[model samples]
Target: MSTTTAPAAGTSTTGGPFSWTDDGAAVTVTLDGVQVLTYTYAANDPQEESPRPYFHPVRTRTGDLVSAYRPHDHVWHKGIAWSLPHLGPDNFWGGPSYRRGQDYRWLPNNGAMRHRELGQATDDDGTFRFAHSLQWVTQQGSLVVEEERSFQVVPGTDSSYTLVFDTAMTNVSGEPIHIGSPTTEGRENAGYGGLFWRGPRSFAGGSIIGPGGATGEELRGQRAPWLSFVGQHDETCRFSTLVMVDDPGSEHPEPEWFARSEPFACMGPAPFFSQEVLFEAGTTLHYRYGVVIADGQSDAQRSEALALAARELLAATQGRNGQ
Candidate 1:
């Protein structure tokens, strides 16, 4: 028993107020301390959103699972550990988040997404001027994915937090969704979200993708696609984001990079069109991605954090030329 329909078509939360939870199925949105967007419209789940939801910067120690590779306590190297909204299960080894946790699909870590907040981790300014639009339709309607992720805390900018990702993915499922880029073709296919490293061997050298680190504009494939690798942990830095589709005239071919010298390093498969992606039920997709968490990674501070996340996703598309 689950149903919710309201905030969409222009948004206006003003980052003013926030809070939600639906134990029955899905829907968890908490944008105060920073982020937490869990919305599963059923039809198979796991692609979660936690911590930021349940309530405030709550994470006293959600089952603490760290060790396989250190980095200030596993910063969710994979997808949501156990929200079950997007399915993440692949513990093939248990270390490095299950060494790829079977590409993750298994959900629920009990504790019902454990959460609880009161204070500490706020920016105020309302935190981010709210703009809300929510929709989750299923049942033969196929699928509709509309999500609004807003952020704010730029009074002077210190702890820093100014994000904005308004997404809309309606396929209804007839064919033709063709939405790639789960690190470019689900990186190893399991959950559709990844990042793994085991430590030592010189902390597994770094650099994941290319273009000073990460950047994609009007991307299709080949014609000099990409596959990256950059390593270093002592100083804080890591990279590995491949790009592949299928091969042959390669709309999505494989190997633009590969180096797995038996746990030695270097691996970029860059799979694009998972298996020839296509959609037609109603065909809908709006892209947005900017995972910027910087402080080190040279080359002039990783090209100044990819030019400040490409100038805020180029003012959110007003200035096209996106990637």
Candidate 2:
């Protein structure tokens, strides 16, 4: 299923150094004629999944697939998405909700983030950027939050690329909204929420890298400004590294990470890992992150260098926006 629309201003159809293809339902970014990533705003997922915008088919500079969608263990685990498992009494992360006493159960509180409008979109001079306005509504069709999301993909070295994601959400539910994760609901160290990523099955048993030369699942729930996962592809046995960096200016700076490489390779900065953040009725919350996707396994030194480069890029972007 797809939706079609007239191209918005600044939308490019001709190929150049970098280009964009907006097919209404989703948008794709390409570099030198190769796709880097695709963001799906109008998903055709089941309501039970609390459908929301996500980035899939994310690729390294060499075009190696690094993302997974609807994996068996978690059908709702899309490639890369800004998902929140707990929002007051609603569930926006999809699948079963983890109640403190009742364990996991399906509830009628699934909320969906529906794309409402497109904002500025540009593809020029080695840069590809886009923005979207969305409405977060509950299963019963009631507004909970108004959100604005933007993305910028930047070229790094020949073997790596960087993507910056920024989001601002305003509470419009008419009351305070509590945002949290399963860990806040009694599931220990299960703080799997916020900007999440699901890696391909071939990435299983990958290496997790963090600050201070940290390597392993022990970094889970640990505070860090950046984290990385190094995985080897199945067919060619080539390695790739993914690095995620949390903006120091975000609502939750240096967030605790929810990382794992045993059962599957996945990692993300969890803002509400162990606590709930209260969003007042008229308040807004913001978050920004930079991701570096490279074509080889990143050792401690390389991962740190790539993370620092991404941080500099994000800082420059924030400065340009006067944020």
Per candidate, the number of residue pairs that clash is 61, 0
Worst 10 residues of 1 by lDDT: 58-67
Note the residue pairs that clash in candidate 2. none
Error of 1 at 37 (Å): 23
Candidate 2 lDDT over 30-54, as tens digits, reads 8766788989987878999999999
Sum up the clashes in candidate 1. Answer: 61
- Write model 1 residue lDDT over 1-323, tens digit each, in one string: 22343232211245454444434333444434333433332212222222211111111011111112222333232221211122112121122332222543423321112111111122243432222333333322323333333222221122222233223335443444443333332444322221222223432434344443443221223222333223343333332121211112222333222223223332323222233234355755343322222222335344444435434443443322111
Number of backbone clashes in candidate 2 = 0
lDDT of 2 at 313: 85
TM-score of each: 0.22, 0.94
Off by over 4 Å in 2: 1-16, 319-323
Residue 276, candidate 2: Cα error in Å is 0.6
Q: What lDDT would each prediction earn against the true structure?
A: 0.29, 0.86
